[model samples]
Every structure is written in structure tokens, then in C-alpha cells.
Target chain A: MPDKFRGNLLALAVMVCLYERPMHPYEIVLTLRQRHKEESVRLNYGSLYAVIASLLKRGLVAVVGVERQGRLPERTVYCLTDSGKEEVHQWMADLISTPTREYPSLAVALTFLPVLSPDEALRLLKERALSLETRLVQGQASLQWVQRHGLPRLLWIEAEFLLRLTEAELQYVRELIGEIEAGTLEGTDFWKALHESQELSLGIILSEKAQYPEETGIRAGGQGTAPRKRTRHG
Target chain B: MPDKFRGNLLALAVMVCLYERPMHPYEIVLTLRQRHKEESVRLNYGSLYAVIASLLKRGLVAVVGVERQGRLPERTVYCLTDSGKEEVHQWMADLISTPTREYPSLAVALTFLPVLSPDEALRLLKERALSLETRLVQGQASLQWVQRHGLPRLLWIEAEFLLRLTEAELQYVRELIGEIEAGTLEGTDFWKALHESQELSLGIILSEKAQYPEETGIRAGGQGTAPRKRTRHG
Candidate 1:
């Protein structure tokens, strides 16, 4: 993998475009947009030009020709050099064959689940499950639309991968919610106890703050002190 | 939900820690490490201090006291302000319920999988399957170790979430590899033909560059011109 192209999918996309044939930066962007590659790769005119310049510097791509259409400025056509072709293959191989550690935001939230009351956590998980279900339906519809139109699956395999991930996550979250609802989730009692104790202390603090609002910075609608009456579940 | 704390999980983590009790920056780091929260949260002394300073500036946390042990400088103990407590709950809820679009590198690679030949893609997918399997095994073993030690499920639920995601990806990759190997992957023939035509053209270009190495900037080991003989599979 080329060091210059690391973590820059736009660069890879540009090289892939050039590998098909020589194209100006604008043409590359248009082709990518036409193919809807932007769904996976972030694209912008400035970054596209920057990626092209870096590729040119690395000799992964070269100027083949320039095109000027009417009032438009001359756009330099770029073609994939041999090194560029090699780098694309090696980089794709590395990406496909290796599993790098990624910190998903959901994982971070789950790590601190105890911070939220058990009931609140359960409510949030149910909300997430509903959202995931909506997305899965939409994703499936799009995948089917592409297939019905006779578009090759290879073009949208990434969408399929994302759909599968969402499905797994939704299933996990649903099961977690079930466990909490059934009072079977380990440490539910402890989690509830912890929240109850905190609520008791918070009640005391809120009463004191109400007496001396100025000293505690507790202005109306300022300190999120809305009453949070704990609701018990069967 | 605080604008200042958006996408800043460290700030959220700090607030969660202070919710337990007021602690100096060093103690916060120690507690997070002890709980193995670093597995999910990126932790560093520098970043932790920066997050603390930012929280202070935002008034999400306030210095409550200072402590000095021996010759050490006074360490300021910070507590979560009322707004900070409210922010943590809102942030956690938002993160759990909202499914934000994340650009995983694998998705980007899959978008351009056609850049590699069918045989190469298959080989790389098989390699990926092996790596995923190894990780799943290690992840399961650790999760089991935690369970065996009587650790609360709440503490390691994030690890479980990650393991499920890996399992899903591995299953999808294996199915993809199987389809490719069986010659049933959509557009396999087209993909093969595309690569074959490119290989033929590449052969011609390589020979041309080899003849005029100086003109094309093809130096020894500089231009990645290593022969790539097409290997057909059954």
C-alpha cells in the first residue's frame, strides 16, 4: 500500500477511475457520481483535485491530455501509471484481507451504559431497534431496485455489507432490550440500585439548589433539573 | 446534546467518571484504565487533560477542590456540574438511538472490488475470513473470561457488540467468497473479461515502457512493473 494514499478512499476512487481510461478531474467526479460511488466515498471538487495532485506527485497517475469545452477552463486528463495500478491492487488487497480496529460510537456508548438508568437504557435500545428496522427496509428496497434494473451486484456490494451489519446490530439490540424487560439482564438489580441512590442524592441537591439558585447556577430551564420520576416495570 | 460535547466521547466519559465522585485528572485516567474502559475509549494523558480543560471552559465541570500528595503539585479535583450531568444523559441517549452514517474503510474497498481480478478478490476474501475467525475466537474467549470471573455483563457489553459485528462481517465475506469461487457471483464473467482485457493492454504498456524506460520514468524497483501473470482457477 502506498503511504500517500493511506485512509484516502477518494484517491483510490480516482485511480480506479483512471484505470478504466484517462479522464479529467471533472470527468472523474462525474463518472463517480453517475455510478453513485459517493455513497461510499466522500467526494468534493477541492479534495478531488488535491487527490489528483498527490497521485501525480507519487507518479501513480500521469497527464495524458487536456480538454477545454467552450467557456470551461482546460482540464488536464490523467491516466493511471503502472505504479498507480500496482498501488491500487495492493491497497485494495490490504483493505480486503486485513481487519483494522475501528471504534464505533455505539460501542463507546455501550461501554458507559451503566451511567444511564436501566429504564432509560432500555428505552433508548428500543428506539434504536426501530430506527435500524426502518433503515434495513429502505436498504433492502434499494438493493432490490438495483437488482431489478439489472445493475450488477458487484457495483453495490458495499451497500449489502452495510445492510448486513445493521441487521446484526438490530438483532443484538433487540435481544438486549428483551433481557432488560424480562428482568433477566445480569446486574439489573445493581444498576437499578445505583440509579436509585443517585436519584435520592440528586433530589437533595436539587432542593438545596432551589433554595440558593444563584449560588448553584440553577436558573429556570438552565440546569436541566426537570423531575425524573423513576417508573417501575414488571 | 450539548453542542460543545458533540462527537467528543472523552468529554462524555469524563462527565460519567465525575458523576461517580469528584476526582483529579490522574484519578479519572486510573479509574478508566482499571475498568478496562480504554478498550472502547481512546485514552491518553494528553487528550484526557485537554478534554478536562474543554469541559471546564464549557462549564460542564467545575473544580471543587485541590489535593497535594508529598512533593507533587496540587491536583484539581473536578466535579460534574448540573449541566454536565444532563449533557451526559442526553449524549448517551443520542448515541444509542441515532444510527449515524460511518464510512468504514472496508466499505470503500468493496465499492472498488472490481479493480482486482476475480481470483485475487477471492483469495483476499478468504484471507479476511481467516483473520475474522481468529479475532472472533479471541473476542469470545475474553468475553467468556469476564463471565467466568463474575464480572457484570454491563461492564463488557460493548465487547459483545463488537464480537457480533465481526461475526456478521465474517459470515458475509465467506458467503461472498463462496459465490465468487462457484462462479455464481453476479457479473463474475464480466469482471473476469474486464480484467483480462486490461491485463492484455497492461502487457503492451509494460513492454513499451520497458523499451523507453527513461522517457516513461520506469526505473528499477521504482515503477511497480513486476510481471502479473493471470492465474485461472477451476
Candidate 2:
């Protein structure tokens, strides 16, 4: 699905892949790497498989059939559902026609705030919050799901992160509505702050872009897979 | 590429796309929708062709061959180059790795400000700034080549966005160094501002995630994508 799809990128990529051919996880990874390389694809075994499994549950993707071999675990050959195809097309059309805010991949989430009326924005937030809340509860519902699952320890943290964020959105939207109700929002600091926030984000974005000098050729720092030490998961 | 990738989501998505099959413009648009629907990948026809041609020239992607059907224009199949592959991987890897200051995206940029200097932070910013300068030059050269072709009107705006960004970076870097030279930065509003800005941005990010409400579905404002007096593209 294009940007208009209003979902995640890797999920869509996974769908595109499944749509192309029913694929086992390993085969999917293989094809992704082959089309270009693992580096460019920015996919790894851990995140990749996790997203696949999630998609399977969402009904966007499913196991059309299975592939088995002697030694290794039986492989699940997944394919995009009709619903998934519709999601892709619907999103693509949205991209072409909508004048909605352009959401950036990771950090651009904030930019979408002004795109909707506060009510609509609040509704979307609540929707996301509910999903995150479900993930927080239902995901950790069974001890077996948590214990047997070899997800990054941070997987749990992501839900928590979402919970915090939605709570924050709930607060902000309330504040926004309060402002509107009170008629205090007109030319106020919050509005200005909201506006300035865009510049600040842009500034941050621009600054990041600036860090890379145009003249020099690629350096060691410029290449893939800069390793990490985690603090909190988002 | 991960969110940590130096480039934004769209740029990373485009890079990841090259890892797939070689695509002409229409195909690129189709491919993007087919895969990453959330990206809402949109391009004026000019930017699409221009980005592809530059990617080809930069060795990020290679033109394997071209095909011409009866009525349509020629289509060139562009494959990602080795360097492109490496860069993409680096971006992906960095997304989850490389812990630094809290909220590394903006903090990383601010670190370059001389006003914020501690010996270690200064050293980090210097290293980062130096690296950024190199990339900026290369990016500019790439944009220049893009302009050499009959450039699209909006495409130039994108190019200018990049260039102006680079210019801002250079300016900031210089300003920061000067601030370090002057004693004013240490006790200046910058310090307070830094703390406030960080709190705001981080708060916004976290709040959006945690505060966003659960979906109570809603519809549009009765009107569809209809033309209002000066609706979209205004």
C-alpha cells in the first residue's frame, strides 16, 4: 500500500511480497534480500518474522499452504488476502487523491495532528490507543505467549510506549477541545506551540539532514547497520 | 531503513524499494503502493523520473536494461548497487541500535551546537558534523545533476528543501562554534530552551503514543474529495 494506506511500511512490504507469491518466512526473506540486498531492505530475521506473524493474525495475510522439508521446521507459505489487496489499492488511491498530511516513516507521526479536526484526530488517537491497549493486555494475556515468545524484550515496551502516547494525545486533544470550547485557543501559546512544533520538528529533520556533508564520498559512519544500546523502547 | 536512518521515511522507503525489482516511474509508484501503503508515496511525474535517474547515476542503483512497448515510453530496470545495499543496511541497523543522548534524533543534531559543548559532546558533534558535511556536498551535487535535466517546478522545491537544509546545517555548525568561543552560551537562554525543547518534543512524541484515544469510529464531514472554493493544492 502506498503512503495513503495509513498503516506501517514493513507490513505493506510484507503484503506486497505475499501478494507476489505465497512464501514461507525464509523464502520471503530470501526474495527480499535477492531483489536488492539485506542492507537496503532494512529487514532482519527477528523483526521480519514478527511482523509476518502479526500480519497473519490481522487477516491481511495468511497461510495459503505449507512447505515442508526433512530437517528444519515446516515452513508456512503465506499469501495476501483479498482484504489485503483491497487495503493496498484503497491506500494507493488515498495517496493519489488525498490532501491529507504526509506522514513520515518514523518521527513524522506528530505532523498528522493538524490534518484532521481535533475531534477526528482525537478519534484516531483513541482508536490507536485501543489497539495498543489490546496489544498490551491480550498480548501479555497468557504467560505462555510471553514466555514462549522470543520477541525482543522491548516488544512489551512498545505497547507500554503506545499507552503512554495515547494517554498524552488524550490529554492534548482534551486541551485542544477545551481551548475551542472556551474560545481561548485563538492565537494562543498552545496554537503557536503547535505551529512552532512543526518548525522545531522540521529543524530537527533539517539538522539531521545537514549532518551529512554533500562533498565527501560515503564514509564508514554513512553505511548500514549502526549498532545500538537500548534504553527505552518506543 | 530504520527510523534511525539519517534520511527520512520516504527516502528510506525509496532506498528499500530499489532492493526490489527494477522499476520505471509508473512501476515505482505501483511498487510503492503494492508494498508500503502507509508511506503514501506520491511524486509528481518529474520527481519520479528525476530521482530514478539520479539514483542510477549515484551508483545507488544501476540501469540493467530498458524496454519499449508499442505505445508507452521506454522503461528502464534499475537495480540497487552494492554501495546502495551497504547504506541501506547501515540505515536499518542504526534504527534499533546506537544509543546516545536521549531521543537521539534531535539530540544528535543539537549536540553539534557549540553552546552545548562538554568535551565528549563537542567531540561527538564535531565528528557528526564533519560526516554530515560530506553527505551534504554529495547530495547537492546530485541535485545539481537533477536540475540539469528539464527539472519539474515542484521538484526544484524539493531540491531547494535539501539545499537550504544543508546551508542551515553549515550555518548552525558555525554558530555553535562561535557560541563556544563566546562565554554567553553557557548561561544563555539556549540551555533553558534546550531543556524545554527536549521536554516538549519528547512529551509530544510520548504523549501522542500514550495519550491517543481508542478508536470510536467516525466519518468525514459529509463532503467527499469535492472541490471547495480553494480546497486542496492551494
**Winner by lDDT:** 1
Which whole-number lDDT from 0 to 100 does residue A188 have in model 2?
34
Interface RMSD of each: 14.9, 20.9
Please tell me the TM-score of chain A for candidate 2: 0.38
lDDT tens readout by residue for model 2, A1-234: 333334444564566556555777777665543322121124567777888777777677878787667776888788878887667445433322222222322222322223223344335444444443443343234222433443222112222222233333334434444554454643233334544443323121112122222233322223422232222211
Docking quality band of candidate 2, CAPRI definitions: incorrect
Predictions in order: lDDT = 0.73, 0.42
Q: List clashing residue pairs in candidate 1.
A: none
What TM-score does prediction 2 earn? 0.25
lDDT of 2 by residue, B1-234 (tens): 223325334444455556544555566555443222222234345566666665566667788787888877777777777787666555543331221111212221231121221343344445545656765675566555544543322212223333343445445545544554463443334333444553323111112122111221211111112221211110
Residue A146, candidate 1: Cα error in Å is 0.7
Best by TM-score: 1
Candidate 2 chain A has its poorest 10 consecutive residues by lDDT at: A202-211
